[model samples]
Target: MAEHAHTHTSTPSPVPDLNRNRLPTLFEVLSRRTLPPVDLFSFYIYMRDQQRSVDYLDFWLDVAQHMSLCRHYVRELRRSVLVGTPEPEKDSKRSSAILQGLGEMSHHAGPSMYATEKERDQDAQMSAFLREDRPGAHDSPQSSNGPRNRPSPGISSSRDITSDSNSPAHTVARQDIRASAEKILYTFLLPGAEREITLPGSITQDVTTAIEEFGRDDPEVFDVAKDYVFQAMERDAFPGFLRMKALGNLIPATLIMRLILGLVSMFGGFWAAFILIFLNETRQTRLWLILPFTIGVYSLASYQYSLDPILALLGFSEYTPFNFSRVREPYVRKLLAQRAIMVLAVTILIDAALCVLFILVPGKRL
Candidate 1:
């Protein structure tokens, strides 16, 4: 009897049904397959891989170095404007242009130029003092012997025994300060080939005006402006690495949610189908009978979810999986492709539904 049953099973069915069903679409395949864990793994791996790249490290370092340079330049420029010896009137045209540029920069970046509110207040006070109209407010009164009553605190006093000269120590201090100031100006004003060559001429004029206006009251303001500029330049120079860093900062939260969702999605469908089959056991006989149905339902749901409008709105696509597949390593692409079929399948279904709705709705309206 067993042999007869085996022989019967071996015989082909009367109707040729082999080609009756179409292969599952991409969306269907994605939806039926496992999901949550694989999705989480992909997200984690992407972030980890980016962190390990040398470009990420170099980007931040470049920014820090540039910012330092800017701070130094601002400091020097401010000092030169304040106490450094005035350029000869013959060079006034050039000085005027430079000053104009500095002034504009300072004006535009006024808030950043001052280190603190206290510094800004001090500057305001100094400006008020300088602008006072009282005669001899800045100059010391003359004594009966035709000498100034008291040397300005800013000037040096030289007590020379051999010659009746002013204080050499004060003169030396002023000279040293002036020399340091000049070095800073040279570095800040002349960026050489590093800066964009096509900047508007107005930029120079604006920066010069800002420097003159702000530096007149407080030299530190220039330092702040210079630092801000350098930092901005550095950010522009290495955008990729900086972007990676920002992404990295969000990795923990992104990875956790992605991982949990992927895991739940991957196994949840199969379990749900099992429950349904179990509940229907009175009507159906075999324990293993529901496996195919469960798989089909899972696949269908996954495909639908992949094409969800919400995900699409967030710049994600079911066909694209994690959206990093094209940019990622080949091995990662393969892994995601293998693991993400079910999700993709669901997405495609949802998208198809939405597309149909859109078309039908528009036609109905017309």
Candidate 2:
């Protein structure tokens, strides 16, 4: 029994060690053609979390600048766009003119052309039926066996394709899909770019307008899209400068600094409270330490809440789980600032009340 116990104690456990799984390589991502749009969005977020997206974007930007602006390269790119010609010249006219002319004429003539053709074909069939009949046509004129007496099954009918094309439901569905795609693109590929440039709804519209103007032709689309993106970035640059100026203003800066320093005080106060309570110090001293610590924590939270609008403006909202937007109105920001002050005051009052309770009930500190 002693030997068995010693053997059991010396033996190692057979539990497996779990390692962190690696993300897919760039090559692996690029090689898979069947990946869904959500996967691309996930990959983008992963790249951002890993802090590699910034460098990747910078590299691409440098490459784009070098490839797009050089005189010879630009000319070569234009030449490439103009090279392919599956569409024959008008003089060569690969498409049949007669068929095109008939289709065009059908638009104006309506269903009457079909009616006339149908009547002529019916008349020919009637004549053929008469030729094959026995010479008793007048006798069989009212008979069910006669071709003329029979109902014509060859009557042609046409449906108006134009009506379906012009339907309100069809138009609305197309618009909805387009809007959804734009939102997805902004959320996944170009996160925060829209907020920095324009308001949430307006940025996609601006991008669509740019595409409309420049995307009509293959040659101009890339250059125009690149320019529009840069233009948006430039627009945000001025506002960021203004924000920096606002941050420098002494009154606001002082408030922000005090709130920050209060966080440190909160840390120290927590430790002091813990020591006094656990080490059997006087109840009054313990209450003093705890009250300031509680007030400090609440104030710090309120301070961060007050800066939400500013953080949203700087495009940090995309990283958050829920939606957040910048308060474009100056009045709204002022209201939030006032609310923050009120919250801090409330927190202090609550802490003071708690301290009074602790004093009144000395045995109930826990």
Candidate 3:
């Protein structure tokens, strides 16, 4: 089952293109590669710094290493068990040697280890049992070499032999696989894990069930959980990662430009409003305040918190940041675009309302 277990997964499991000649990029990994150790580790660090979720990557890396461990244990068990069948003649000789060792320990010669009283009692019991059973069974069953027992008639041909599920080899493999499965279950899937990934109840229950069905009972243990983690990272986390990574790569010159733009928009609008209020001889102008207020609010808030939308606003996303995705993060950018349009419409309506108010009812100087 362990041998067959791998044959199923081997075909679809393409090794991620590491490209050791160049430094690994999260873009390539998130785009075309499976989660490898290095990329995942670096991503884990990035996420950790941002205080984002890293449990998924943690569990993914652990499960991959455990799968390798399962294969290793299975191979070791198979290699060790495939030596040869036991012979009755050799068994009898080994038994006789053990008996001789037990009998002669009391008075061996100059230098010898001593046996305990339990061994003496066991030796006495064995002597009595052998005297009763072998007196008439064979004239000289115990000779100088050893007591001889009849061996098997013949060895079975390779084609005639079949592997038993109850055999020692299978037993050890099951134990190894089950142990591996249990570690995964308790450490990540089960409750009270130090690094537990967020999983639905049904998925958790399925993986728990898989632990009980280790080996041939359930060859695809943790497979569903693995896919879930991978899909989530690929769909949700990677997009945000790509965006953040792009933001992280902004040039000092670009950032200085954004800073200058934000400052000019914010302060320039504020001073313009001050001058308008003064020009009106301290009569507060409502209609003229709308654009300045909008510019000031957006400039102050958008740089840090709303960076992606701001980058798209500055048109950097069309080139550097959005190079990976042909779709251009429509979900996030689209939502932000709607909000921007709404703000624009609201600003215009407010300006019109203030204009009507000023025309119909002029304000006295404050």
Best by lDDT: 3
Q: Residue-wise lDDT of candidate 3 within 58-115, one digit each (tens)?
A: 5665554444333333333233333332223323544344343433112110001123
TM-score, each model? 0.24, 0.24, 0.37
Put down candidate 1 lDDT per residue, 250-316, tens digits, no spaces.
Answer: 2233444544554464455345434544454332333332343333434344333322223322323
* Candidate 2 global TM-score: 0.24
Report the number of clashing residue pairs per model.
51, 0, 0
The superposed Cα distance between candidate 3 and the true structure at residue 293, in angstroms, equals 21
**Whole-model lDDT per candidate:** 0.30, 0.32, 0.42
User: Pairs clashing in candidate 2?
Assistant: none
Best candidate, TM-score: 3
TM-score of 1: 0.24
* Deviation of model 2 at 163, angstroms: 51
Measured over all alpha carbons after superposition, the RMSD of each candidate to the real structure, in angstroms, is 30.0, 28.7, 23.0
